[model samples]
Target: MPVTSIVKDPEALSLTVHAEFPVKVARLWDAYLDARQLEKFWGPAEYPATFTRHDAAAGGRSNYHMTSPEGEEFHGYWEWNEVVEHKFFEVTDGFAHPDGTPNTDLPVNRMVFSFDPTPEGTKLTITAAFDSAEDMEQVVAMGMIDGTRSAMSQIEQVLIDLRNYSQTFATEAELVSDTQVRVVRLVRGTRQQVWDAHHDAALVKRWQYGPDGWSMTKCDLASGIGESYLLWWAPEDGGQGFGFSGKILERVEGHYESSTEQLEGGEEILGSGVPGSVNQQTFTGTTGGTLVTTLITYRDKAARDAMLATGMADGMEASYARLESIL
Candidate 1:
């Protein structure tokens, strides 16, 4: 994790974030100035950002939007007030409408990003000043802290050498918020290959099952938006079986997909102490292969915690590792 601490000062009407990355100051600075790298970590895992235009020079404006798994878009803009290459930059960040018009109804913030070389690597500090304590508290209540932390924690992956982040890397899960968790891994396959492996019944049957002694007994797949799938697994030794059923909510071929998932029996399963969740999966083609990120949004904090406690990520990791081997 790159972010060290996030401090709030009511008297100063500001929120400051401190983070250090093991990289040169120039490299850290470029990650911010370049839209390509910026977008990768600008928003949280589930809501990915896209910068339509970026100009960090003085008097320039950068426009971007983050799209939620449900297709909602949140727009924002940064009006560059000052720029000092490899040192610091100042901008007035504000909320905007989908059409790019400024949304004055929402509170705006003035942000300053400072970069300095450190003994370990580079230190980056960001201070966002607000007009009043009311505005500052409002943003905090809107989950800004967790969102920023989730976004900043992803910087390390973007900063690492591509060779070090290849298919050999193990799967990892990061808690983004009380109700969300992000799992990521590098697969030894192209984005299309990964997508196909997930959709093809034959490939899915080969790897989607759990650990040793378990076999997938049924695989009813759904390949398009608004479709549904049912997958069941049982122990080869005749132990009890369980299954998952989900409905595809969104999809962008070879890139991203989102679906609502739950235990097979719906109300019957819910009554037995299981809650539903939404999963968003995104695949990015990397130099080595494909990077797969799955963001799971649980019904509540308790639900999220329970799901994680069930060793779901561990099972997924084993399944993904098996997929890579077959690929």
Candidate 2:
């Protein structure tokens, strides 16, 4: 939890938030300026924000909108007034229409965020000053206190999980459950480019090979749900080959896909007797690159452990490294 306390003062016409984090002051400051990290916690969990434009310099502006679970969007912007690196910044936070025009019916607040270093970590203090008592009360009535707390609660994960979101990091796998795991990679390419690389036969053959000496011999892909696909790889020195055959269970264009996958051949393959897995993949665009998340659900814990013990993560990293060069 990044936020420790929230104070609302009626007579002072101000709302202040105090949050502590066990990170260097510079790292904490960078997370706010980076749009990728900001979007993760800038809005409430139900209404995640997307920042189409974020300018960090003084006198610059940031344009963002949050969409509710019901698909309604609320636009907002910030006019940066002053910035002192690793210390504090001032901004005018306001509500806006979908067209980027200010909504005069609502109030804009002057906000100053101070960052201080302590023996343990960094402490962030945010003071938002309102023009009138009525305006301050209005925002509080709109669940501002609860919403702010909910937004800041997510910051701890972003600050701690550096490898998961960093573009330069190699592909990694995270355990989701006893019978499930998630493989993630931040690849340098547009979502469409990454999608095409997976679907195009020639491109797939070029990089999907796990490591040197192995080559993709078959790359039959399915572009629609219910269709079947086949992937096979073999060694250059006439070594035994292995492959996976599955049907596309779900397809959402360049955004998401899922299928049932199983190992078919190759005596060298580990956990060959275990039942296969269902893999669902999602592609999300970020400021640095595209985040590819593949969730694999196996038949049981034994099967999941077996697959991971086969050096699967390292193999995937090698392939992703190849993908980086081509893209």
Candidate 3:
């Protein structure tokens, strides 16, 4: 479909605005696929929105509500079907009363999102088709264009900030510097699934380690200090052992504490003679699933330098991609 205006009938009393978001395909896919993220910055001017009863499958039902600052509430729902991640989704949207009564005048839109990667970024084109000209015009005049533009602007900045943080956080010298690393990913799955992936050593071995034939050898799940694990990365190419040996320096169980250890260095590797600081992993439950956080500290300059020199950013990104795949 062509990227056209949402103003269905400008000569009539109503018009709707359409927007195109030039964003990274992965980020855009996350924005749509992750419901928790939908609740964050989904609307313009902080218009709070909640996604309720979302199944995100064919013949399933989902609803959304936008509450204005002045105590006004707008409710809508969709008979969700034909979902293809980062490709397309069709929904029946309308004026559902706060009490769940549907209004027929509002249109049910077939929304399509296509991602085309280019040198600049992914061209995200979102198109919605309304039933009639009047319905299209009504939604258009409600600031759909400006609202979408603002929300997408926020999304673009968010991606940029995340990429910047990934580089700066890894290469920085100070352990607890002026800014700490923060994870804002929206993990989609059941709580049990997320928790299992997190605490299970086998799953961690698959996701946390690099793809060059790496695996976890040991883990201690004690609730106190001094618990530790050794992740052994023995490549099949007859490469030497290269891995991180971590020990719990402090304990907070479910919340977060500190894991201090050292990255072993071989002839091709460089281990930090100084303590490699601590890694604080925090897990929190959300409506859809769990949010996992990892904050690593490299207090020593040499440690940070070695990791960065080995393409830390790419490695970290690959690790995250693996994690997503596992979950």
Candidate 4:
């Protein structure tokens, strides 16, 4: 791994460190914003860190603690002052008590992190400004520079692990029977959140589109059993698009929902003889997060085969991948 460049300016009472990452700016930005990703590289190896609270936005606060090899814990907090997506953020960083209360006895600093895209990858510059030169000296003596470098060295591996995990967790689809197709994904959210993504019209409009250049133009939902729901889609270039409306068959709030879907348009590709399908979705809480299982049962084998031949599974996978971003 490459070493970080650390510069100390006594006259300005500031310390700056420059680190380069062999990854895109979005990946680097996500590593800092996502709590699960942040925990992997926020501290040195011997002193692993865990975040109890993480909200990556202006006016938000993150409280975390590092557990040493000797079993001792050091708590800290960051008050985000400014945040610009994929660019930079400023935070008030300081020590805190175990209960997350500020520790006045410890040194506090204002830190700014700027991210710049490069031909190689992303370059991140972090500058910490102290109240006085004495404060800067005290923190340097306390191993701030060394600890930061060690922590930053772990990010490359973290990004690699994240990439691998995403590939492993991609949505999976299988033909359960001649008339039934099953699609499953392990989403990183609670059962309720996953359910809401399906039931809420606004959220559904955001991720239900299968691929790029397509948008959901309309979404109207009636949550009650026996109610009907309608959705519409259109291409960016004003090309003709297809959509479907469904009648709710079953509803078990936040757990299960079943509907009968009747497709509109694209009849030639979907086979005009193809019948509607009953789509049943189940949300189950799992150790990892929420397991979402969607089963589509056609009226007959011919209908199911026609739908599958139209690349429905590939479209579903793309849509589900988009849902992961919002969650």
- Indicate which candidate wins on TM-score: 2
Score candidate 4 by lDDT. 0.79
What lDDT score is found at residue 49 in candidate 1? 89
Model 1 lDDT per residue over 89-180, tens place = 99999999977789999999999999999999999999999999999998899888999999998888888842233434578877766777
What TM-score against the true fold does each predicted structure earn?
0.56, 0.57, 0.45, 0.54
Regions of candidate 1 where Cα sits further than 4 Å from its true position: 1-168, 265-272
lDDT of candidate 4 over 1-327, digit per residue (tens): 645689999888999989988887877876776555677889787898876555455666777899998989999999879887688999999999988899999899999999999998999999999998878888899999889888988888898878643324567767755777877677878767988998888899888965688788889887799999888887888887777888998666676677999888856545676578998776655445666767788988998887777777678777877888899
Worst 10 residues of 1 by lDDT: 161-170
Residue 192 of model 3 has an lDDT of 54
Residue pairs in steric clash, candidate 4? none
Q: Count steric clashes of candidate 3.
A: 5
Superposing all C-alpha atoms, what RMSD in Å does each candidate have to the true structure?
A: 11.4, 11.1, 13.9, 14.7
Candidate 3: regions farther than 4 A off? 1-23, 161-327
lDDT of 3 by residue, 19-61 (tens): 4445555555555544445555566756777654344555655
- The positional error of residue 301 in candidate 3, measured at the CA in angstroms, is 50
- Model 3 accuracy (lDDT, Cα): 0.56
Candidates 1 and 3, the one with greater TM-score: 1
